[model samples]
Target: MGLIGDYRRLMRAGIALARHDVILPGAYQTRLPLPARIAGRVLRIFGGGARGRPGERLARALEKLGPAYIKLGQFLATRPDVFGAEVTQDLGRLKDKLPPFSMKAARAALAEEFGEADAARLFAELSDPVAAASIAQVHKMSLPEGERAVKILRPGIEHKLMVELSAMKRAARTIEGISAESQRLKPVAFTETIAAAMMRETDLRLEAGGADEMHEISHKSGHFVIPSVDWDRTGRRVLTIDWIDGISLTDPKALDRPGIDRKKLANDITQGFLTHAIEYGVFHADMHEGNLIITPEGKVALVDFGIIGRIGMVERRFLAEILWGFLKRDYLRVAEVHFEAGYVPASQSVGEFAQALRSIGEPVHGKPAEEVSMGRVLLQLFDYTHTFGMSLRPELVLLQKTMVQVEGVARAIDPSHNIWVASEPVVGSWIRRSFGPEGAAKLVAGNVKEITNRLKRLPEVMDRFEASLEPPAPPPPPPRRFAPWWGWFGFVAILVALGIWAAK
Candidate 1:
């Protein structure tokens, strides 16, 4: 039941999708091939009256499937270019919420992580779970210093997730092998990325470290709030952080509070993400409304740092230039950056790519902020990736996904929120600092230092080169050795004794 087991799990998933009318969805039936159309008609009969758009039905199916599928759906929601806006919007609603494990089970997990006596001593006033999600749940506990939230991993989620993810990987491999067109999407790599992120989410220690790091970044940026980690009470399965006493942005009533600046909050959400990514090269990868808390002071507090997006200096420059180009409506510069970043194949024509970029950017410009959709623009840009022979960048997937989430949350807070406008300050400042005269000076200084360092090592490198050029001395003749006469006599004696025994 190795490969067979994967196929069996996939079969079950297929049936679920068929029941939800996601297999050969009705909207595309007319466009499907004759055989596919016939198959779709037959499948719809077993759909159990699944209603809503295909994405909505698929979301229900994935949610019903469990945590792994839910995570996949969330990942797909980030790719509106592949699925379209309406479908992705429906999928975006796939939340991580799940019923909480029992209080007894929660206590047991804590005791197992920290011995029973220590668990009681630390969490004497531990309350019932305040919130629950697919991978873990949070419980509020009181400490002498302050109230803290204790997050515990689900009892047996790791194994369940591993089984489901293995099936998903098999399915991805099957899809890539069967369909040439799917190769550009990199389904195998995509699934692996999601699987890796899901596995990381199970380890609360990593999450604690992420929280602490982001807290420091937040202090410097003053853009968002991050909870302080309680190191003394934390463990691999348990993360203790200062409990945030605020309303989650997920609540419909969250924005209705007095003193809340909806417009400013929206801008802050957009700008905060850009500032973190462009300036610091790290950001909370999961920026969904559920994970964002609007404190009483109206500051956005990010929690559940199970996923964090990071980029190297090269990617940061690529992102900054792209954003800056878009802000200035210089589609050519944007296209050039893509080429320079090696995202677009060298065989592709730069002018043609620039034209495609223009198509995506010009429409959004001069339009009312509420009328424009950053997600839609990204969708078109992703579409161009295929047209321009650009492959999916695994490293940028999380960053792209988080960008969409940030835009969605920001737009929800204020419909008139203009991300491009918000981005200009951060992106523009970064571009100026990175590509201007000051940047040129730093580049020259760096090159000079590099050359000086190499010059210093020249003598050592030359010595090694000369040493290799010289011939090696011949190996010493095999060590001379001689058996003593007594040794030879003993061998003969042994042979004679053997001969006598044989004669007897």
Candidate 2:
């Protein structure tokens, strides 16, 4: 009955999606079998068709399906490789905002995280929630003389997500059974990724910690701004953060108001994003217009630390070299990065991949800034990589999506903004610093420190190794084969008696 109910709900949601007016008029009309059409018709009979722009319709359908679906749509929106640009754009506008929890619920959460009495003493004022989302909401508050924003986790979000995600997994499995394309996507794996990210977002403490780490990393980098956390008022379900005042990066006109240099703003946005990506190896995974703001001093202010991506040192260096190669118009070097990073299978010739890359890079090399679209380059590369049996890497896919968004944001501010120009200086400096003489010294120091630590633990390691090598005592013998002679005879007798009784 539980499985049946879940299947029924999922079917109903599918019908709702089919009827959604924004599904490109005939989204499900792809020469499917008569039975499939009949099933779709049955679904339409249960609900009205979608209405609104394609993207807007998607958002609406997802919202109706529930929080888990909305989140799934959001994740897909970040993958331009999966969904086309139009759909991705629509999903990008799908905000996670939902109604805020009640004061009673919020208080309960606070009490659960930090004793109610302690929470009361920590804040001078506990205002109502000012904003809400799928995982949590923000409340305007005061803490000792400073104004702050308090994010409180929505009550029971974890339970809701788990239930819905289980249904989603089941649905994904059913879809895979019906569609071979879905099999290649590894829907189960993708669902797990979504589930893990959702789980992390539900923990307010983790996000608060992420914000603090980002803030500390950027404290000396004047180009970036991450709000400070008020630790005293922070807890498991609640986060207290310093408030930031800035214009939304999406608002170019407002950004231009009062002498905001569009060029400089564009540079700062691009450089700040890459700096985080290459230098710190951590970057804001969600780079929509909403998460970025431009302060009065023209510094870019980043908010919402729920989603971030990490690339190891090797991958970062490889990415830097790829970007450098592309900028230098060295298709061979760019191809080499893909092979070296194991993005391309060694079985494929570097020369052939370089030729494919040249097809993607050549057309855009001398094009005007406005004429060249990074999206095209990315799409071409994605399609080209498939010829060499290079499967998509979700992390890299996320990075590409982010690059698209960041590039779009920068261009909106300055129509002719050259992304390559902004990236060159930052990427060049990072490369030099990473491989320069000083960097070599730092590397040597790190190796020496590691060696010292290992030497200190040498005795303990040897003792453990010796202990592992010592043979264990022999196991007790099996209990005389479980007296199989009698047990088997009795089992066979019962089966024979049952068969005879059935025949009779």
Candidate 3:
């Protein structure tokens, strides 16, 4: 099925959501259009006692829809401004877990990747799958060198994702077409971003490269542990990496170890993410508790490289300045950064934007770590996006999403975790290095070097400019070709026939 198939899938999805009372939720029914209100009432009849907050109902509906919807829910969880904090929080709880595929199926996949004989030789001691997610599952295997974790993509997940993503794109387009406000959110672009990320996740090769890069970054930062990739055993559908022995952060007992320092661990989570994003410009975008583990050595180990966030130097500066400005309670500077970054429209008043920022910041100024919710603050800030003519920045989606995840994980590790306090040291250090006198000198040097390079190419540039100044030669009299006698006679005859018909 192509377009028709997408419509069918969307219809099914709509029905499922309706049954869960997710589409035009009851609370907002009165405010909706007459037709929509009637539709919601009719759909709610099929709800079958679907109970909970609208977010909860939607999460369950999406989970029931399958992996692609679950991923969509997770992506939507990042936009607390559009969905609201409670709804997004509920969406955030949408797990990627799925029942593990059969061992026979797993072996078949391995054999397909590496010929049967090679698969047998390599995974002779392959154990049962230890964990399974929507896209893939992991198995522990013993290699000649050491123990390795083998990740295998689900058999038909790629095609499944393709179909669902197509339907989602259609839905996003439909939503945008129907609502003027939704255009600012760029639902189509947002869906495409999700689609691209999901497609990338299907290819284990990309994950392997990301894992290796993060491993190197981890080594430098010494704030997190990243397992080494086993390149020899890796393939498009399979990834083999060193098996990590640790308790997952999701385990309640992960932080119960005698030597574990909760406060330090919490700070490390926050600082480590900032350091990678600001300094290295790359980070593990998926930092949920399940992807993190507490090693026996009392270190935090990061896993799952399927989603990595990268930012260029400009975004790095934007992030650092924004964080630093917030830490300093300089709402004006924060607003300036937003304007400089072009996140807000030029038509918006900078002073008024600063006042809005002050509103978000002032309330949390002296509040205790536990009392303040960064997630709420972020929600409010994003809510102002519409007020200030701000649109969604696709490039910063992952960064924003990961920030919320990091904050949540940190708070879980230590309830009193203060992201602002934890971020100050890292953010401040970066600001000092980047905005200080030394930074100015480097900036000027870079500009002068660029100018020097241009000067060297001046003769080449002048030659092109001079060449463009010359007028084009005229067409050579239509190749001096004449139409055949019959052609002209036929044209004259056609004109005469038309004139005769008109007279008649």
The total number of steric clashes, by the backbone 3 Å criterion, in model 2 comes to 4
Residues 1-504, model 2: lDDT tens digits:
268767656555554565564322346546554444444444434335445666778788787776788888989887766666667767877767787779988888888888868866775487988778877888887655677888888888888888777778776665555555557778878888888887787777898888988898788565588999888778777888987777986566787587788888788888988988888888887877888888777788888888777787778888899988988899999999899888989999999999998888889887899888777788777676558988656777777778888888888888988888889999999879988998788778878998999999999999999998999889888533323335335433433333233223
Query: Cα RMSD (Å) between model 3 and the true structure?
Result: 12.2
Candidate 1, run of 10 with poorest lDDT: 494-503
lDDT per residue (tens digit) for residues 243-359 in model 1? 998888879575887899899998988899888888888899878888898888888888888877789767988988888888788889998999999999999999999999998
Q: lDDT at 426 for candidate 1?
A: 86
Better of 1 and 2 by TM-score: 1
Candidate 1 overall Cα lDDT vs. reference? 0.82
Query: Which pairs, if any, clash in model 2?
Result: 19-49, 19-50, 20-50, 21-50
Clashing pairs in 3: none
lDDT of each: 0.82, 0.76, 0.84
Q: What residue pairs are clashing in model 1?
A: none
Candidate 1 contains a number of clashing pairs equal to: 0
Error of 2 at 118 (Å): 1.7
Top model number, lDDT: 3
User: 2 or 3, which is superior by lDDT?
Assistant: 3
lDDT of 3 at 125: 97
